[model samples]
Target: MTGLHERHLAVSPDWLALYYRHPLELTHGEGRHVWDADGNRYLDFFGGILTTMTAHALPEVTKAVSEQAGRIIHSSTLYLNRPMVELAERVAALSGIPDARVFFTTSGTEANDTALLLATAHRGSNQILAMRNSYHGRSFSAVSITGNRSWSTTSLSPLQTLYVHGGVRTRGPYAELSDERFIKACVADLEDLLGHTRGVAALIAEPVQGVGGFTAPPDGLYAAFREVLDRHGILWISDEVQTGWGRTGDHFWGWQAHASSGPPDILTFAKGIGNGMSIGGVVARADVMNCLDANSISTFGGSPVTMAAGLANLSYLLEHDLQGNARRVGGLLIERLRAVGAGSPAVREVRGRGLMIGIELVRPGTDEADPDRAAAVLEAARAGGLLIGKGGGHNTSVLRIAPPLSLTVAEAEEGAEILGQALHTAT
Candidate 1:
């Protein structure tokens, strides 16, 4: 097959530059690997921003999508579909919420928008509280709550106060706060913000900050926040767009990491739910979802094909015990990475749970700045047949290694070896 780079060079339009993409064009993918248009193979540790938890081109998902496409692709929301109902039931059952009701959307952004709307509707309030360095989505309402200004340019109106504190950083005004102090401060901030504002509607946050460099906050953070929200009569929204569906190894739902506390009033999930089929959902408490009228609908949210794909994906995950694999393999990978970092001056920190891992790189000086050597390390890794991602505020120089759950031990070791080689080469 001809490479997309070659074809683009010959005939592609100039508008393609609007988006930043890898120079290589992928032609196909299977399991934990992808082939460039030129047939060069590369191990995919990135996993489409951690969306392909079960891996690319899964057999069962492909068969389900094909069969459903043959039967029916889409229908108006005014009509009911068997596949949609079945998928919803399975999701509710797996999520441990027997009376859960689902509202589907085509992407995580839409799912977030739906969740925010539902929360505001239930409380009839406009004020929302969110954590700093947290990412919900890119839509108008979702972006309004996002703490990153790079992703959003529109000036936030007075109605929204995107809280910007209590994340993983050693410097700044928040540096004085320890993990426990930070959690307490977050709760205090929410309470103070809600004091003057009557009828504060909801508070939304990611269980583990993803785009903010996979930072996991202190333990009991969720429970403390949940308590504050309950006291103020506000809904707690869990944005599981990246952490949901077994990527976090220890639990099926990333929020389960905080099971000692209480569950969120509303949960939004996407990324891996449809195994790359572009499906997302808002799973809310039965009472909260009941406020929506029967007339509320999405034209293509729960189409038969996407529903079938979702069912097949979930079934495969359960049958193969991919979540167990994620936990075991991810633990092994983290141990090895930590060992590698033990003696390396360039590595500032290693953090993550399950398959979601990040390695923070720091310079040799006392400035505590991101080491450009880490960027060179990633370039070297790509040249050495491995692909990784960089993230965090300074682009904090993290090597994001979130491979498919189906990735084998041998493949994981090989990728790590290449990363080691890349690190040495860059140094």
Candidate 2:
């Protein structure tokens, strides 16, 4: 009866309750596992909502951070850090964007905000288009482009009207309208909006929707959108906050997942880039970046500490072939999940690519919402020593599992087995 829980006093409230967090207070993590204050270990399939990609306590990252902290930490934007420049160049080279200009930020939201502002500044346009159910970030400009209603408040400034595209329905998640039909609908919407709208700046999209249920746009969706943007003299911005850093597998840059579409005018990346080191960036063609005035700047965006961490994280990713690991483990995990869910009455669908997986739960006798069951599954998984998160438009049912790229095949199988048991208990 005497434990940490007993030592702590319960209060009505002091901290902001933004999310429904588990009762566990994580005290330490190593690799893909975390330990709560009570010393109970849990497999971190969630990876801090897809942030800790290189896993926790990576030796190289730790060493870099420690060294940088001892040498130099923060310096004004007026001065440049060697590590910052090196990391930027490495990112450009790895991303296959030759001579790409990089602007750093402390978080995904800030990176996205910078991208949006740069798009408008370069094109002298205000309107921006984003796909429905898309999540950009929480900053004002980024939130304005996000298509989710739950993330927005009533008092928020009016969103500039722009075209929304994709995510059509037919039968199931993958059985939706043909890829061709989906592309046509998207093109038509863009064309119509561009013809009537005053100044459309950018067409933004996720290579693979992250918070939007790990959904991938239909084939040709990106190419068609690129064509439409070119026709209207608009910029294409690929928001790879969650999908970048090899999470999608097969490529270093998430946008490469849709190479047929050609390169985006502006690309934003965060989350996995620094392996939870609070670094994000906007990489753009030199021409587009040059449009920004000399007045544009950030203070702590590319601090030495963060740059060192990023460099170490990037090195670890390449040296270990983490991208390849993601593909191999993700493929096996997907196959296993599909096999497990094939005949389950509670499973409505299992859809996703690479490590970004989503398991949708269905109501027993109806297509209606089933948030209760989803919550039950989440609780059961936590109790069973596994961690996962929820996503999707309705938030009714979606178990998002995006573990570290370093996660092994055996670990994936173990997580899946635990998930199966949790689902069985919940259902």
lDDT of each structure?
0.79, 0.80
Best by lDDT: 2
Stretches off by above 4 angstroms in model 2 are 1-22, 167-175
**Model 1 lDDT at residue 98:** 43
Error of 2 at 290 (Å): 1.7
Model 1 worst lDDT window (10 residues): 13-22
Residues 248-321 of candidate 2 have per-residue lDDT tens digits of 77776777756886778899998887887999999998989889777866898998999999999888998999
Residue range 95-209, candidate 1, lDDT tens digits: 6654788888989999989988888888878788887777777778887887765455467643465473555545446566887777777668767777777777888888878
TM-score of model 2 (CA atoms): 0.93
TM-score of each: 0.91, 0.93
Candidate 1 — which residues are off by over 4 angstroms?
1-22, 157-159, 169-178, 367-374
Considering only N, C-alpha and C atoms within 3 Å, which residue pairs clash in candidate 1? none
What is the Å distance of residue 220 in model 2 from its true position?
A: 2.5
